[model samples]
Target: MSKICGGIFTSHVPGIGKAIAQNLQNDPYWKPFFDGFDPIHRWLAAEKPDVAVVFYNDHGLNFFLDKMPTFAIGAANEYRHEDEGWGIAFARPFQGHADLSWHIIEHVVASEFDPVMCQAMTVDHAVAVPFELCWPGKDAFPTKLIPIAINTVQHPLPSPKRCHDLGKAVGRAIESWGGNEKVVIFGTGGLSHQLEGERAGHINVDYDKFCLRNLAPDPEALLQHDTLDIVELAGSQGVEILNWIAARGALTGSVRELASNYHVPISNTAAATVLLSHSERVLA
Candidate 1:
């Protein structure tokens, strides 16, 4: 049977990508942010999972206000990076795990989570930035990808609890696959900092820490807040916590937080990163 080795929770700020592209890791402004992933890089170098189930939100790259799917899964053979209007050059295409992608899509829908299956999709910073952080270069990208796109840009996003339930379903799907591949899931985005309006640079340090503290052993605690509640407390874009909740839900048994880093004002956001692994007693 396949196994979920672990899950990664990260804040995928576009500026992080720019910092790396500009080779500013040693620069004081970006040093801490870049250093935070050193442990993650070492961990990935050790684990070498065969496939990565990446959960991210597109910042209007593929979907718009006209047609947006609450949940979408990419089943393409390869995924290409997009410009996102920043004039960033596209990265090398990421190989896809079609078999695992189909398995997840089939099981997710069977389990009552309606998901739009995309035969093709373009990944933006939300997806690309994390990959760049974990696997520094294209040669270092160890696993095929299964991109899971969630809708958080528009109103009526999935509730925190709902996202968790969906992740649980995805976990079941990965575990049920007969292949012997190892898989890792990633929940990208959040920590706080609203962009727009008068509160453009608001950062809720207390709430962000509260989430980091309770995320592992008691994720259900976060389910109490609706999307609006998160927006009011963590900031407008703080609703991205749903992605983290979903990734946390994907792991069976309790999680062991391997590493965590939090820094302020990473281009108008509270940047954060966490690495989690399943405890010894996981569902088989």
Candidate 2:
């Protein structure tokens, strides 16, 4: 059976993608932010999971206010990145693992987590940016991708507990699949910063650091946080940390933090990244 070997957690801010695309990694202003991913690249090269179950949220790209899903999983054979009007371009399309996607859909749904199965979806920066950060290359993505988008944009977002529960279901689904694919789950978005209203530049670096310290081994403790608390402490968009919680839940058992980083003002957002490995080796 296919098994989830590990997971990656990071922010999906668009500015980071633009800096890398423009080759500004060496610039002092951007160096510290870009430098954080170096260890991730090495880790990706070493682990090289066959498929990445990327957990991200759409930002007014595909699902608008008209319709939004609380939880959605992409079952497409291929996914093309949509232009979020940023014009920061040139990441190739992502290849999707359809068989594994279907297997996961079946098991996850049966496991009582009802996620809308998307066969065709145009991914936005939420999906593309983080992919570039971890597996930077132009030819093609080194690993196939299965995007699981959570509804962080809408007001009535899922609770942190719900996201974590769904993630655990996904981990179970991946493990139950009778395939040899090595799977890695990713929870992308948020270290803290609100991008709207009078508090456009609000950031809570201390809370973000606190989250980073506990996310690996004590994710359940974070479930105590509600949307209101996150907004007040972190910022309105700061609730995006729910994505990180979901990714943490997918790791299955105890996780070892391989690498972690944090940077503020990555385009008005406090971006962060953490790499985790399952304490017990998961073999296919």
Q: Which candidate should be chosen as best, given TM-score against the real structure? A: 1
lDDT of 1 by residue, 1-284 (tens): 88888888999999988888888999999988888898888888898889889888889898788879999999998998887887894466789988888999999998999999999888888888888888886474678888998888998999888899999999889989999988888999998979989988889999999999988878889898898999999998888888898888888666888999998879999999999987436366
Question: What TM-score would each prediction reach against the true structure?
Answer: 0.97, 0.95
Q: Global CA lDDT of candidate 2, please?
A: 0.85
lDDT of 1: 0.88
Number of the top lDDT candidate: 1
- Poorly placed runs, candidate 1 (over 4 Å): 138-140, 279-284
- Each model's lDDT comes to 0.88, 0.85
Clashing pairs in 2: none
